[model samples]
Target: MTATPRAVDAKEILLTWLTDQVSVPVVSTRPDNKDAPATFVRLLLTGGTGRHDRALHTTQLTIDSYAPTTAAAVELALAVDAAVHGAVAGLSPVVRVSGTSPSESPDPDTTSARATATYQITTRLLT
Candidate 1:
């Protein structure tokens, strides 16, 4: 049988993923109401099983600004992945993102603008 990945390895990967999620360039767009710009970032993972089952863990990153489209979100996701690798390599795990959307407030705020980017990270436990 093959050996499973270690907790340290897994966590390291996750942490690295988290770091990448935020500190990177992502999808962006120009807003009609505002010119501040918007950005989105997120990281996610799910794995682990058997005698060395690790608890499920998730890391999420969201950016809400006037930057623009889902491009920022995509960039952020990639960045997060890179960051995690740089921060903590050897985290040989898998991660999947369900969705990436750009949303704005129906109502205007003092700034008269609203937008957001969301990201999710998740891990699973197997017996």
Candidate 2:
């Protein structure tokens, strides 16, 4: 079995996958100096579960897609959903991506919108 990948590893896997499949920036945090792009994605590790004696884990994460319009945000989110909804080959510890749940809202005080896609990834725990 593969060793469990760290949270950063999981994020990198997701970032690479998203950047390869979609033509947009996939970031871990909002950019500090530059103006936010018209469309971008942020990957966040929300939670996880593992057992003491077992080498298996389930990780949860959210991919937040931001865009200038609700329709655009939804479209970007759907694309991410399609990318993550099933097994992805690159994640080291992640054996499979089980599913995704979606939510959407307007970015604070702006015309921009955000679509958050939550994912559940099954992995082999490493120790």
Candidate 3:
């Protein structure tokens, strides 16, 4: 619904933002069956919907951070949350971000920790 035929890929935008802000590598999906980096982030598009009449769309995103230690994971997660919670408006293609919730967990690797931060973004198509 943008003025042009192209629609913004919110997930990719967030991934780039995280990569730039966090100074960590971000991937859209975990590799087929390989161990992820000891300190990295993964971006997932959990949900999305659009309203044709208003030319508006909402995307739900989850950013997962992994670190070698719980403390590091928490710090990284906090950084990710801060970077995303109010960042959409500054990015290209224009979007508003909200509804942030961050969680931390011990990774199955036992030696690593993981943190997940979720956010909802609403984007309006240019007329």
Candidate 4:
């Protein structure tokens, strides 16, 4: 008898990877810090797919880079893009990583400038 392949937590994997690679704090949700830094990255898992017969998983994520200024936000978004691509070799399970160009997306609630980008990460799950 053969055992079914296990599903991986794509969000956790990405959060862990980005936290280590990025200079700024990487969080899944808005920080509760009373004195939050001027720059930070927030990650949201938009969607994903997996097969029962295979250990391969693909996850889509939205990355929001926030800063005090629009220029700073854009710079941070670019840095994040580089860091995400750099993970392809370092992350064992990750098979590929792709992303769209970061665009300006100012936040409605705050005066902080924001940049947004989408990424697709494909990983091979361990049995």
Candidate 2, residues 10-127, lDDT tens digits: the string is 6666778788888899999865455778788889888766442365667777888888778889899988888775335654666778555557866675567888877877766555
Candidate 1 lDDT by residue in tens digits, 72-93 = 4444444544454343333333
- Identify the candidate with maximal TM-score: 4
Candidate 2 vs candidate 4: the TM-score winner is 4
Per-candidate Cα RMSD to the true structure, in Å, reads: 9.5, 3.7, 3.2, 1.8
For candidate 2, the per-residue lDDT at 100 reads 57
lDDT of 1 at 48: 27
Worst 10 residues of 1 by lDDT: 42-51
Tell me the lDDT of candidate 1.
0.40
Model 4: pairs clashing at backbone N, Cα or C within 3 Å? none
Task: Report the C-alpha lDDT of model 3 over 1-127, residue by residue, as the tens digit.
Answer: 5355335677877787777888777888754345657788888889866544466667788878888777788788888888886576567664667755667766564466888877777776655
Off by over 4 Å in 3: 1-6, 31-36, 109-111
Q: Going through the candidates in order, what is the number of backbone clashes in each?
A: 18, 1, 0, 0
Report lDDT per candidate.
0.40, 0.73, 0.73, 0.84
| Whole-structure CA lDDT of model 2 | 0.73
lDDT score for residue 63 of model 1 = 40
Model 2 poorest 10 in a row by lDDT: 2-11
Candidate 2: stretches off by over 4 Å: 1-8, 32-34, 51-53, 86-92
For residues 1-127, what per-residue lDDT tens digits would candidate 4 score against the true structure? 8666665676788788878887888888866467877789999989865553366778889999999899999999999898888878887788888879999998897778999999988888666
